[model samples]
Target: MRKKIQIVRHVVQLIFFILLVLVVVGTVCSFQIGGFQFTEPLGAIQVLMGGSIFFTPEKLYILLATSAILVTVTVLIGRAWCAWACPVMTFNEFIEYIMKRLRYKPVAERGKKKIELGEVRFATLAGVVAAAGISKTPAWCNVCPIGAICRTRSSGLLVAGAEMLILGVVFSANMYEKRFFCKYLCPVGGLLILLGKISSLIIPRASEKCTGCKACEYICPEGIPLFRNPDMSKCTKCLVCYSNCPYGAVKIDVI
Candidate 1:
């Protein structure tokens, strides 16, 4: 079942990535289905923060309506966007695969001290919001890799070049760590983390049948200890532990 889930997730990621490219080419508007818009929640927040300096209520209502789907999805699935749908994650995986082929091990696999960047992520979120309000612009979006990809064909060469440079730097950082951007730097992911805390999504969790083997932690991309007091905030709902568990200790709580 876990194998099947992973397969489906990869397919979904690929589909979304393709749709994102289509969006870049002006083939589609927002992620819309059945006449409803699905947009990035962080984008809406940034717009609200930037425009609120002048008290833009019209934009507020429009943003709220557009962002509703994304916000609800985050609350239901705990960053499934990051793991299962985001084009950024798909591209990161490609980089990771190339790095592995070149024998560059990730920090987690190196037995080195992993730097905690959760605080940095939150600080970035605050900084970007502050910058947006003061500048009356969605400041971070200008440098955001996701935004970069979406605007690549639509924006000027210099603008797109700068955006891809930021994306390249972020992706290259993964040579030292798996998912460096998603784990530590994405303000969008930071916002989703808060929403994901209230997620009702049934995920692979350590059951009473678990031992103290710590196998799940060793395999977890985020290094969360499933049999221990794991930080669910960092969980991307990847379920790698569920598939790799030797004792079948990780099971989804259907209730």
Candidate 2:
């Protein structure tokens, strides 16, 4: 029964990943065919910061309010977006799939050992701060491929640049490690880590059942060792650990 559940979850994750890629491709094609102008929606924060004002103040206010609500929810729900929603992450997984099929595993069983807070994370934050200080708009969001891809149908040049940049980085990372983007870059993942600390939902360990076989650790895509810290910041809460656990030791709960 447990194996069946794991298989189903894996299949669902793969399907969602494929759908996200299709959405990006279709949106870009539609824009090319329709000749629509790319208009970005403005948030209150963006307006206050003196960034590009694509939308009215009223709309920006609404956007800000919506962002606040979403951030609040994220603080309570772990990085659900990373696990089940983010198209970039989904595409990353698809890339992993390609590597796997070719028997060229991008991730290793031993897991990549590294500290949670490192120079890369600090540099990323510093860049965000500099951008925010200089411009009303957050530079991180401007460079986000997810937003770029979603708007590809309208903003051909911008989308092309974004895709080219992301693909270059992704390919380079794959040449080194499986998910270097999620590990060292990704401003969104950084924000999600901050939210994850207060998340209502978490992956917990069943100490009684765990035999310390480390199967879950070996299979974890994020390099999280469940035995060390079940609530590691990098965990996407995809439930892959729970599904792969030979002892069924990992579980999810509202904390």
Candidate 3:
């Protein structure tokens, strides 16, 4: 049963990765081949964050409605968006594949590792401190390659250089550690972690079946100990832990 679940999970992940790649390709091609201007809805989110009120009332209403929907989903399912929907997560998975193909192992092995929360906390704190000290928004978002990719795409640049640069960094980092971006950075991931604690659905451990073998921990990409706290904020509910556990100790349950 565990093997079957793992196979299914891998298949689903593969399909999702393919879909993400296609979306990016299709969007770029629409502009290049079809001569269609690609407008992303998330552009409004960025514009609003930038304090631009140029959008019509109708547009603002739409953006608010979309945000409400996203919040509802997050509230219901934790960071399901990070796990199953985000294009960036898809790209991160692809980078993992390439790293594996190159025989480059992540520095942090599953059971033997934990996400260095101290590092992440310090970095986030530093950002806040810098922002307050200098009265600036800090350089985090400016250097975010996702924003760069969107900007480049909006400007009609096919094969976005910024995206490539980010991919290069991810690949290089993966040669040393798995999910370097997810662990130490990624503001979207940070936000999800903060909100996931109150999520309706959470991953939990079946303590009765658990043997402390640490197989689930070894399989977890985010470096969480499934046995320690199944409701871990960083867990994406990817099911890798549940599928990989030989003892069938991990399961999804309502929190």
Enumerate residue pairs that collide in model 3. none
Any runs in candidate 3 off by more than 4 Å, and if so which?
Answer: 10-21, 24-46, 54-56, 109-142, 147-159
lDDT per model, in order?
0.75, 0.60, 0.59
**lDDT, residue 163, candidate 1:** 65
Assess every candidate by TM-score: 0.87, 0.73, 0.71
Highest TM-score model number: 1
> Please, what are the lDDT tens digits per residue for candidate 2 over residues 1-255?
656765665666666545544433343111121432222222223344664544576755655554565466567776666767566666677777787799885543235763454537547755665677687566556665655555544456455776668666766676466666776776666666776777656655545677778777667766677876555656777777777788788766646
- What's model 3's lDDT at 204? 54
In candidate 2 the C-alpha lDDT for residue 227 amounts to: 74
Q: Which prediction has the highest lDDT against the true structure?
A: 1
Summing lDDT over every window of 10 consecutive residues in candidate 3, give the lowest-scoring window: 28-37
Question: How much does candidate 1 score in TM-score?
Answer: 0.87
Off by over 4 Å in 1: 23-34, 52-59, 155-159
lDDT of 3 by residue, 1-255 (tens): 756765665566666544444434443111222432332323333445444444577766655654555556666777666666555666677778787799866766534664555447346634544543454333444555445444455545566676667657856766567767766666656655665667766655556788888776667877677776654777776777777778777766766
| Candidate structures ordered by TM-score, highest first | 1, 2, 3
TM accuracy, model 2: 0.73
